[model samples]
Target: MTPLLNYIVSHTKLPEVSIKNTVELLNEDCTIPFISRYRKERTGNLDEVQIGDIVKFKEQFETLEKRKAAILKALEEQDALTSELKQKIEATQDLTTLEDLYLPFKKSRKTKAETARQNGLEPLAKIIMSQNVNDVESVAYKYVKGEIKSVEDALEGARHIISEWINELTDIRNNIRQQLERFAMISTKVVKAKADDENAQKFRDYFEWEEALSRIPSHRLLAILRAESEGFIKVKIEIDDEKALTKIEDRIMRSNNDCTEQIQIAIQDAYKRLLLPSLSNEALQNAKTKADEAAISVFAKNLKQLLLGSPLGEKRVLAIDPGFRTGCKVVCLDAQGGLLYNETIYPHPPKSDTIGAMKKISSLTEAYQIEAIAIGNGTASRETEAVIRKIHFKNDIQVFVVSEAGASIYSASKIARDEFPNYDVTVRGSVSIGRRLQDPLAELVKIDAKSIGVGQYQHDVDQTKLKKELDVVVESCVNAVGVNLNTASTSLLSYVSGIGPKLAENIVAYRDENGAFTSRNEVKKVPRLGGKAFEQGAAFLRIKEAKNPLDDSAVHPESYAIVEKMAKDLGKHVTDLIGNKDQLQNIDLKKYCTETVGLPTLQDIINELEKPGLDIREQAKVFTFNQNIKTINDLREGQLLPGIVNNITNFGCFVDVGIKESGLIHVSNLSDSFVKDVNEHVSLHQQVIVKVLDVDVPRKRIQLKLHK
Candidate 1:
C-alpha cells in the first residue's frame, strides 16, 4: 500500500488491513452502506460514517497523486526537471505546497517579466540582485533595446523581472497565505438604493456586519454571500494592508541600498498586482468551502433525523388536505396505505356544509374502519379538526395534525402520478399525509430531500455537495432499517444498499410477475441481478413468509449454515431457537469463530434472532395543542403550551405551537446550563412544553422558553 493510504488509516484510527480491504472493495464498485453491512468481516465492523471517511480520504490521496504526476510531466517537457527539484516535489504532501514549488517554472502568458526578458534586460535584473549601494542606474544604461529606450526604462524592466521573482518565491507565498488565513475579516454593507425595498428586508441584519472570517458562523456566511449575490450588498474580505505588506517585505528585502529602493518598488507592485488578489481569492474560496461543508453536515444530520422520525405503523387512516374556499379534500387509506376512497368536504368558510361534510366523514370512517384521522396543518385545519373531534363514530379515532410542508410537491411528482393515475393532486396529497403517519422513512424518500424543509440555508449551499451528503444520509437510514421485500414500493426500495432506481423497478416487477420473494436467494433470480448485488442487498431485504426463518431476519445467506449448525447442536428447529432467549443463552459464540466470522457478526446475528426485524424508531404518539390559543394574537406572555419541534438549525429550533407562526426556541433558552447543540435538547417531531417568553402579533414572531 502507498504511504497516503497508511496515513489515512492511521488518522482515521481504522485498522490498516480493514482500510486496505475497504479501499479494494470501493475500487471494485462496492457502496459504503453495502460494505458496512454485508462486508463487516472485511471492514472490521466499521460503521457507515467510518467507511465514508475512508472513501473521502482515499479520493483525496488519489487526487494528490494525480496532481503530482501531472506536475512532473509538465516539468519534464519544459526541460526544467532536476534531481533536486524532483526530490522536493516528491517529498511534498499538500497540493498547496506542491503548486507553490511549481509556480516559478510554470508556463504562462507574456507578462511584464516575459516582455523584459525578450528585450535582453535579464542581465540587468541579475546585476540589480547583487544589492550594490552605488551605480545601480549606471548599470541600467548598459541594457538598451527595443522598448528599453532610457535608463529609467531599463530599471523599470529590471524591477518587473524582480517583481515576478518575488511573486513566485514559495516562502513568501506560503507566509502571506498564513497571514491572510489568520487575520483576514469579512465586511458587508447594504446598498442604500435598495434598503427600502420589501424584498431586501430579509438581509437588513447583515448590513454593516463585520466579523473574522475564521469565526463567522456558517449560516451567517451563506446569508452574507446570498445578499451580495442579489446586488443588495457589497462584501469585502481583507486584512490590514500595511501589516501584511511589512510581513512580505521582511521576507524579500535582505539589505538596504539603491537596489533596496528598486526591490521595495517590486515588493509594492507584487503585493498589489499579484499577492493580494490571488491570496484574497484563495482565502475567500477556502472559507466558502468550509462554510459549505458545515452547512451540508447540518443539513444531512437534520434530514436523517427527519427521515427516521416516529411512525404510526400499519393502520387504516383518513387523511384530509384542509382548505378554506377550495374545500377540504379527504382520502381513505387501507392498512397497507392503498387509497380506498376520496371526496371533498366543505366544512369551513364560504360553503360551511357542516352537516353534509360530517355525514360523509362518519360514513367513510365506518365503511373503511378508519383507526386515525390525519389533518393537514394548513388553512382551516383547526376548524376541520374541531368538526372531526365532535363527530360520533362507532370506533374511536385518533386525530393528527401532520405537517404539510412538502405534500403539494409530492402530489405533483411523477411517482404520485404513476401510483394514482386516475386521481387528482388533492387526493394524492391526502394519501401522502396518511402514508407519512404510517411510515415516515418509506414515504419521505419518494420526494427530494431538499424539499422536505428540514434544513437551514439548504438552497444557498453548494447543490452538488448537499445532494451527495443527503443521499448518503438517506442510504444509511434506509439500510439501517431493513426493507420489507414483499411490500416495499419502488421508491422506498430504491434506497436499499445495492438497489438503484432500475434495480428497484426490477424488484417490484419481479414480485408482480413471480409472486412474493420466497427466499433471500430469490433476489439473484431477478433479471440483471448478479452475485455482488445480491450479496450487498440480501441482508437488508426481509421476506417474512420465507420457508427458512433466517430469511426473514437480517442474517446473510452466507451465514445461514452457521445458524443452522447452532440450531442442530441445540437439538431444536431454527425457528424454535430464533426468539428463545433461554436457548440462545445456551449456545457458545466461540464455537462460531471462524476465520471470517468473529464476535461482531455473531453478536449481530444473535441480536437479530432475538428480535427479528426490530425497529429502532419509536411509535408515534398523539399530541395536543392549547385549546384557548389558535393564533398568535391569543398567545399571552408566561402562558405555558405544548409544541412540536418542526425544524432544527445552527441557531436554534422552530417549534410548531398549533398556529400560523412557528416559535423560535433559541439555544440559550434550552437549558439552565449551556446547550451546545439544539438537537441535543430536542429532535425533529419531538414533543415539548414551552413558556411564552414574547409574542409579536403584527410581525408574527414568537419567542419561547423550554418548560419541560
Candidate 2:
C-alpha cells in the first residue's frame, strides 16, 4: 500500500490525502464512477479521469510488485540474491529497470557464453578483462584443455565469455538504451515482391520512409508497423555503430595492450550481436507502447463523444436502412424503440419505385404516429430521405440522417439476436437505426465500441489496452447519464457503478419476476445486490414516478434525510422542494454541512433538486446535406457544402458531405492558425459547412477546409 501510495502520488501529483483516500476506496472495490459521483468529499472532488488514473497506476504498481516477487524468488532459488541486489531489485519502480536488473539471472536456452563458461574459460576471460596481462596467449594456453582444440580455441571461448560479461553489465545496457532513446532512426523499405499488389497500395506512403523513432507521430508509426506486419515492407531501427562502440570502449579499455585489443573485439561482438539488437527491440517496443497509448486515447475520446451524442429522446421513429439494388429496409418503432412493423421499399436505382416508397412511408408515419424519421446514412440514403421528405404528412416529422456505422455489426450481434430472436438482421438493423436516433447511448452500448467506427487505426493498436480504455469510457458515459431502472437493458445497466453483467442480469430477472422497482430501497430485494452494490450503484439508477420522489433523482438514498431536513426547514414537503428553483436557491447550504457531508455534496444536491434526472446531453437536431451534391462526381473545388463530422483523430476529422467518400479536413485546414486538437474545433456528429479544397474523383478522395 505504501509503494502504491507513493507511486500514484508521484505519477499524478494529486493531493496526498485525496490520493490516499481514493486509493483506499479503490482497494475496497469501489468503482471510479461511484467514487467520483457519490464519494466526492472523500475524493476531494476528483473527476472520473483523475480517479481512472489512480486506478491505472494502482494496477500498474500491483503488476510491478508481483513481477518483483517472482524475480526475487527466482534469484533466491539460483543462490544469487545478495543483500545489495535484493535492495536494488525491490527499490526499482518501473518494469523495464527491474527487468534490466534481472536480465543476467533469467534462465534461457544454452548459449555460446554458457558453453564457454561450462568449459571453464570464465577465469581466463577475467584475466583478459583486467587489461594488465600483456602475454594473453600464455594465459589462454592454461585453459586449452577438454573441448578446447588449441590456444586459439581457448582464446575464442574467453572472448565469448567476455562478450557475455560486457552484455550483462547493467550500466552498459542502460547507456545503450539512453543512446537509442535519443538517436535511433526507424526505417522501412518496400518488399519488392509485393510492391504492385492491390492491397499493398494503401500502405504505399510508408514504402520508403525514415523518421527519428523518438519524434514520429503515433499514427505514422502505427501505419509503418502495420505495413510491416502485412508483409508490404521491412522496418528496422538503427544508430551509428562507431558512436555506441566508442561509448562502451571508453568505459572498459584502460590501457593499450594485447589484452585491451582482445577486450575491444569482445566489445564489438557484444554491441553488434547482443546489446544493440536487444536494446533496439526494447526501444521499438517502448515506442510501440507509446503509439498504442496515443492511438487508444484517440479511440476512447471519439467513442465517448459518439456514445454521448445528442439523443432525439423517445420519439416514435420510422427508420430506413437504405440500399440501391436490394431496396430499402424500413421499420416503425415505438417511443421505447420496440419494433412494431417492418417492410422493404425500393426507392432507388434498379427498382426505382419512388412514388410507391413515398406513399408507403407517408402511410406508415400516419399509422405508427411517428414523430421522427431516421434514415441510415448508407447506400442510397439521400435518395431515401428525399423520398420521405417529399411526402405531405399530417404532423411535422423531424428527419434525422443517422450514422449507421455499427448498426450492421449490432444487428448481427448475439445481444441483438437475444433481444429479437424472431427478427432477422435487416429488421434488427432498421430497429437499431431507429433506436439510435431515439437514444444514441442506449443503442450504441449494444455494439462493441471498436466496431462502432469512431477510431483511428483501431485495429492496428493494442487490442487489450484498447478494449479496457473503451470500456471505461462506456461505463463513465453510462453512469454520467443515469440509467432508467425500469427500462434500461441488461447491457446498459451492466455499466452502472458496481452493477456488472451478472448483477445487472439478476436485477433484470428480479424486475421481470416482480415488477418495476418502486423505490431505491426496493433494489435491495434483488438477489445478490447487497449493501455495497446498492451503495455504489443506486445513485446512478433513476426511476420515474417512483413512490419516493427522490428515487427519480441523482440524490442518493443516504442523502434523503438531509434533503428532507432542508425541506422541513423550508416548511415544505420534499416533493414541493424539488424543481422549485426559487425555494432551492434560498436555502443556506452551510446549515446542512456535517462531518460526512460538505459544501460540495450540498451544492450537488441542490443542483440535482433543481433538475432531477435531467440528461447531460443535448436534444438531437435534424441535419441536411447539399441537395446539389449526391456523389463525388458532383463535388467541385470551393463548393460550400453542409457536412457532419463522423470521425475524429489527432491529425484531422472526416466529414460526410453527402457523398460516398467522406472528405478529410486535415488539421491544417481546420483553422487559420495551428490546430492542436481537432476535437476542440469539431466533435463527432457536429454539423458544419465546409468548402471543398480538392476532389480526386478517380482515387475517391475529397479534401475540405472549414468555412470560417
Candidate 3:
C-alpha cells in the first residue's frame, strides 16, 4: 500500500481496503454522502464523517507531498542537497517540522546578524561559543575589519550572529512552541480613545480580560480578537519569561564560563527581540485557527438542527409578515405551498382598523380553508397574534410563530424571483414563512445557511471552511430526510447526496419540460444524469405512486431483489410487507444477508420496511409566549416564560422569548447538574421554559436559567 493510504488508514481506523476504495471513488468525483450511503459494501459501512475525514487527509497529504517536491527542487538548484538532508525532507510528513528544518537554508533579507557574518565575525563567534577561554575580548581583536572597530564592537557583532544561530535551532523552536501551547496567557485591554464609544460597549467584558490562552473558550477568544480588529481593544499572548528563559538556556548553554555569560546575553536578546514576538504570534494564530474550527463546528451543528427542524407536512397555510405602520402582509398558500392570494391588514394601532381587519381575516380563513396560520416572528408579531386570536374562524386553525431569519434574503433572491416573478418581496417572504411550517429542510436549502442567523460569529470564522462544513450539514440533513421526487423544488433537490447544483437544475428542467416523475427510474432520463448519478441519487428520491413500492423506501434498487425475495419467503407482497411491524419483526434479517450485503445493510433495509419514507425529524408544534412580556423591560426576575433556542455557542445558548433582545442561558444554568455540552440539554429551535434570572435594560441583556 502507498504510504499516504497507510497513514490515512492508521489515522481513520478503517480497513485499508475501505480507505483505498473510498480514495479511488473520491478521485472519480463521487460525493461523500453518496459514497457513505450507496457504497456501503465497498466502504465497509463507514459513515459520512469518516469518509469526509479520509477526503480531507488525502488532500492535505497531497499538498504536503507537493511542498516537499518544491523544496527538494529548490535545494538541488542551490547545490545544498545532501543524501541525509534529502532523506530527512522526504521522511517528514508534518508541515511545521519541515519548515523548521528549512529555516537556516531559507534566503532572508539582510539583518544585523547577516551583516555581522559578512564582516568575518563568524570565527570569533565560534571561538566564544566553544567557551575554552575567558579572555574572549582579546580573541575578538583578531577579526578587526572595515565595520569592526573596538573589542566591544567585535564582541557585540559576534553576539548578534550567535543570537541568530540560537534563534534558528530546531530544538529551541520546538521546545518553545510547546511552552507557548501549554502556558501562554491571552490578555486584552481597551483602546482608551474608544473606551466610551457606543460600538465598543459590547466588548466591555473583554476590555480588561486575561485568561490562560490554552484554556480560553472559543467564543471568548473570537470575541476578543474581533474587538481588537475593530480597534476597541488590544490583545497579546505571553508566557512566564523566567520559565521560558530557563528552557532556552538549557537548550543553548552547554557550559558554565565567561563565554556562558556571553551566550546568556545572546539568549535574552534572541528571546526579547526575535523569539517571543514571533512565537507568540504563531501561537496566537494557531489558537485562533482552533477557535475558528470550534466555532464553525458549533455553527454547523446549530444550522443542522435549524435546517432539519420539525416540518409540519403539507397543509394549507395562511402566512402573515407582521408589521405596524405598513400593516401586516398576508398570503394564503395551497397545501403544496403555492401562493394563491395575498393582501394587507392593519389590525394594530397606527390605523387600528381592527374591525375591518378581523372581518377580512375571517373571510380569508373561511375562503382558503386554512388549516394553520404562520406568523412571522418579527416586528409587531405579538400584536398581530392577538388580533388573530380574536377572530372566530370557520375551522379550528392552529397558529404558529415562525422565525423570519433569512426569509427576506430568500424573498429577494434569484430563485425566489423566478418562483414568484410578479409578487413583491413581502408576498414572497410570507410564502416562505408558510412553507417553513410545511417543510423547513426543503425551503431552508434555498437560502444561504449563514444568512439563516443560527450561526455565532459565522462571518468572523474562516468563511471557506465554514461554507464547506455547512454544506456537509445541509447535504447530510437533506439525504437523511429523503426528498419527494414529484414535488421537491430545485433548491431542495440540489442537496440530495450525489445530485448537486447542476444536476438539480437539470432534473428540475426535465420535470418542468416533462411532468411529475412517475418512478425512481425516470430520474435517469434527466439531462447529464448518467448511470452513476442515478445509482447514487435514486434511493433518496421518493416517488409516492410508483409501480414498485420500494422506490419510496431507502433500500437501493440493486438490493430490491433481496427485499422482494424476503417478502416472497414470507408469502406477502412488497406493499403488504412494508409498515407491518409485526410481520417485519417476525422475519430474520440474517436470512437476507449475502456476500455483498452485511448486517448493516440488512438492518437498514428492515428499518426502511417498517417506516417507508419516514422523516427522521420531529413534528413542528405551536408555541405561545407570555402576553404580558413585550420587551426586556416587561421581564421580571423569577418569572417562568416560554422560549425557543435561537443560537448556540461553546459558552452558552441564546433563547428568544418573543422579545427584541435574546436571553443568554450560560452553560452553568443549562442543567441542574454539570453540563459538559450545552447541546446535550438544548437544541436550536427547541421549545423550552426559562426563568428570568436578571435584566439589565441599559445594556439590553437578559440572563435566563433553564427550568430543570
Please give the distance, in angstroms, between residue 20's alpha carbon in candidate 2 and its true position after superposition: 1.0
Clashing pairs in 3: none
Error of 2 at 369 (Å): 0.5
lDDT, residue 124, candidate 3: 88
What TM-score does candidate 1 reach? 0.95
Candidate maximizing TM-score? 2
For residue 181, model 3's alpha carbon misses the true position, in angstroms, by: 1.8
After superposing candidate 1 on the true structure, give the runs of residues whose Cα lies further than 4 Å from its correct spot.
Answer: 105-123, 133-145, 148-157
Which residue pairs come into collision in candidate 1?
A: none
Alpha-carbon error at 509 in model 2, in Å?
1.6
Best by lDDT: 2
Provide the overall lDDT of each model, using Cα atoms, as 2-decimal numbers: 0.87, 0.92, 0.89
- What is the model-wide C-alpha lDDT for candidate 1? 0.87
- Give the backbone clash total of model 1: 0
Q: Which regions in candidate 3 have their CA more than 4 angstroms from the true location?
A: 14-21, 115-124, 133-157, 255-262, 568-572, 588-591
lDDT of 1 by residue, 531-554 (tens): 878877888899876898888788
Per-residue lDDT of model 2, residues 1-708, tens digit only: 477789999999999889999988988989998899888999999999899999899899999999999999999999999999999999999998899899888836588888998899999999998888879999899988899989999988899888988898989999999999999999999999999999999899998999999999898999998889999999999998899999999999999988987898899999999998899999999999999999899889899999899999978999999998999999999998888999999988887999998889999999999999999998888888888878999999899999899999999999999999999999999999999999999999999989999888999988999999999999999999999998899999999999999999999999999989898899999999999999999999999999788999999889999999998998889999989999999999999988889998899999999999999999998888888888999988989999999999888999999877899999999999988888899988889999999999877989999997
